[model samples]
Target chain A: MKHACKRVSQLTSDSFERELSLTEKMQLKLHFAMCSLCRNYHQRLATMAGIFEQMREHDLNQDIQLPIEDKQRIQSVLEKEK
Target chain B: MVDKQMNPKLWLKEHGDYLFRYALSRLHDTELASDMVQETLLAAWRGHERFKGDSTLRTWLVGIMKHKIIDHIRKEIRHRDISDRLEHDPTSTYFSENGSWQDSPSAWRDNPEALWDNQEFRQVLQECLSHLPEKQRNVFEMRELTGDDSETICNAYDITPTHLHVLMHRARLALQTCLHKHWFGGHTKS
Candidate 1:
């Protein structure tokens, strides 16, 4: 019975990831305390978030260069609209 | 022409990178994407009066770009894969899998705030975003990656706010789940 309940709560990733209200966090925390599976699940979520953050840093350094001609062309087009 | 409410040039200067990147990701052509970016700027300038500053300047620009993307998509030939549907509707996998959290915990168990603060993570996320359906990817990119508001995003995509929310919700959920599998090797650990 307890294991089944854990499975259901894990499925609520949408609700969990969205900006939860304080009340929702408190409720989630309370539930986690009671359910070991939820505790583990929440931990995994943290790990995944950490990995994603690191990847963003790497991408930021990889320059997305807009060539001078492209910039000029874009500028010229916008200038014409004026 | 810069409007009284917004200096079109300045807006372009500040957000052109993101807008261009957004366009490039979808069209997959640098020149065309840049052209779309410029078009979005011009269109925004012409329609500046309609913009009441209800949403951020970035969001407003994205909304214009969204229309341009749709117009572009309609003009071009899209190669639709009949097999793509099988990958999208993953309902069968969900039910058939063993119901066990012991192997796969939730996702991002560490600090939620810390999840997006790293370099490699962003690259993986970018790769993941590329894999999403075009519409869902665009919506996700605008909202999550670019910090655009839900209302403005809906307006840009010509979708109901409910639809916008649903798309965003699904995108994030899929991303979170996929990243978990990648980082965890199919087995989540605290």
Candidate 2:
């Protein structure tokens, strides 16, 4: 059971990276049904994924400005290369 | 005729910030990101005559930037093994010897969606990400923010699938721990 908890946590993380096999999926479900701790951990992992998606969306609207000096510097460098 | 809209100066004014942010999010270094944007613009200018109108100017510029970012990362990872720098067994502290969680995750009082709406929460998320180790940060950003596939990431980083998984797992664990402490009002570990 202890090893199963470790595997469950690992599988939770793996779900985001790649597709899991049917056996992996079944094992995780079984573990979650019996372990409230693993269940909470799984929920938090899913929540974290959602939060990351929000961050990506937020980045799109983020006001990240390049400095005027850097812009001019780049222009000068480009001219030199031309 | 070269597109009159392809003026380099005008392009800089309009798309510089967006490109810089894109590079910054990926590279996480101000000077390096700036250099990348500069290189991207220079390449775009040089290749302007060949640029067909099928793609938007911004898309073309970003497309250039993505290749540049990939090239830079490839060169970087070739110098050393990124996994060597990782902290050993980062998740072990949270789990007991028996493989059960030593400290089970607590329910966050604040709704995550609501937190996303809060600008401060977003800022904290960035801070947490920045706090991650270099390789882990790179892997996480490439996978999550850039939306690169696992195969591409593994190939670019010169890591096996198992190595990639472990790095990502450690990165997520660290980020969650950081957010729980800093954003969710959990105890700050020393």
Candidate 3:
């Protein structure tokens, strides 16, 4: 049961990056059926991804600005091109 | 004719900060993110004629910046020791020789959507993220936060899909463990 949880958790993360094979998907479905611990593990990962998306959205809503010196440095480089 | 609508000076004054913020969010380095913003403008300036107008100028600029961010990560990872992590599960420490979680995960206090509006939770989330090792953090950022494809990450880091999966798995494990301890707090170990 413990080892199955480990495999399921790993497969859960892999599902984030790619499509899991049919066999792998079945394994997760079956494991998750009987395993609440792995279900909690999956929920935590999904929540982490959600938090990042929200964090990015919040950052977008803010009035974040670039610093003056960096702007000046970039302008000079543009000036040199002229 | 080269588009006169695209002006480097104006873009610098207007779109610079948005571009910088976009880069900073992904790169997490003020200097480098700022540098990428400048590089995006210069590249846009040089290649202004190449842009066929299917997208807004800001969108076009962001498209360029995305590539810049990914390429920067690729360069960084290529030079570093991706091999050091080699199929070695960092979470093994969290598990016994048996695969049960030493610290089994529990439900977080709030739902994800509600947690978004909570400033304190966001602060703790950022702190947990900041605590990650650089490579795992980068892998997580590129794959999760930046929405880069798995293939791009796998190809750039010279690792297989499984290795990339392992890297992200390790990151999620660490981040979840961290969030539980810091955000939940009853079980936090010093």
Candidate 4:
């Protein structure tokens, strides 16, 4: 609802990716104390990141096949490198 | 990097196919993915002494291939147009006002469980990936799926770091909106 609150909400996403500046962490904590919208926004960002992480883990475990020619090509390349 | 004592020929014989498949999933191009995989092994051979085996050799090989894919994308960017716009305006009946997993995007998001359970998620994923423009898909698969750094991705896609950010932002926005429609649009859990 306030200018500080909006900036604080933005910090939630930024913070999830990396460490927040001391000022950012303080500003967000202050805003989260008073702003429900920013709190919900922060929750949503965390939820989305969590869901995406699960999707990635799902992808890594999926079985797949590589074509024969591509396999041979990689072998040749590695052999040349050796 | 493969060890010096490890014969390049023997190393290739042992791991080439696995590496090729790994690269193929990310690049989705047979010829190019192969070339990149080859380059990765070559780079590994040249840089073998640097490999302290902190992880498995397979992990090391994958790290090299990932860089190679980025390098390939950066080279390809010169031949194409680049845009950071989201494609959310595609007519869809299954989305809410905010494009949640509600009203209008329902058609696309519906029945994800069936797809997931049947291993058809892979098929649906491939279809969705095919719908993306090549560069956008590459950026999505590399950054979002493969855990590549933005700077390395920027180098791979031949984009300024700023453009790379915009492209990635647009990609996730588009995918979230699209997937909401097809994967979760209207199913109230029973």
**Top model by TM-score, which number?**
3
Off by over 4 Å in 3: B78-84, B155-158, B185-190
lDDT by residue (B1-190, candidate 1, tens digit) is: 2345477777677888888877775566888888888888888888888887778889999878877876665444243321123235432233324543444444343454554654565566667777887777766666554455666566555567656655654565466566666653454443
Per-residue CA lDDT of model 1 for A1-82, tens digit only, reads 4344334443444353357667766767677777675666556545544444554444542367556687777777778888
- Two-way DockQ contest, 2 vs 3, winner: 3
TM-score of 1: 0.57
lDDT of 1 at B18: 83
- For each candidate, the alpha-carbon lDDT, in order, equals 0.62, 0.81, 0.78, 0.59
Q: For every candidate structure, what is the RMSD over all alpha carbons to the true structure, in angstroms?
A: 6.1, 3.6, 3.3, 6.3
Evaluated against the true structure, the overall lDDT of model 3 is 0.78
- All candidates in order of TM-score, best leading: 3, 2, 4, 1
TM-score (all chains, Cα) for each model: 0.57, 0.82, 0.85, 0.64
| Lowest-sum lDDT 10-residue window in model 3 chain B | B181-190
- Candidate of highest lDDT: 2
- Tens digits of per-residue lDDT, candidate 4, B1-190, equal 3345456555566667677666776667767666766677788888877778788777877777777776666555655655444444331232334433222211232333344444444454556656776667777677656666777776766677655644554444455455444444533445
Clashes of 1: 36
| Of candidates 4 and 3, the better by lDDT | 3
For B1-190, candidate 2 gives per-residue lDDT tens digits of: 4467878877888898889988887787888888888999999999988789788899999988888887788888877655544447777877888988876777665666777888877788889999998888988888988777787677678788988898888888888888888877654423
Which number leads on DockQ? 3
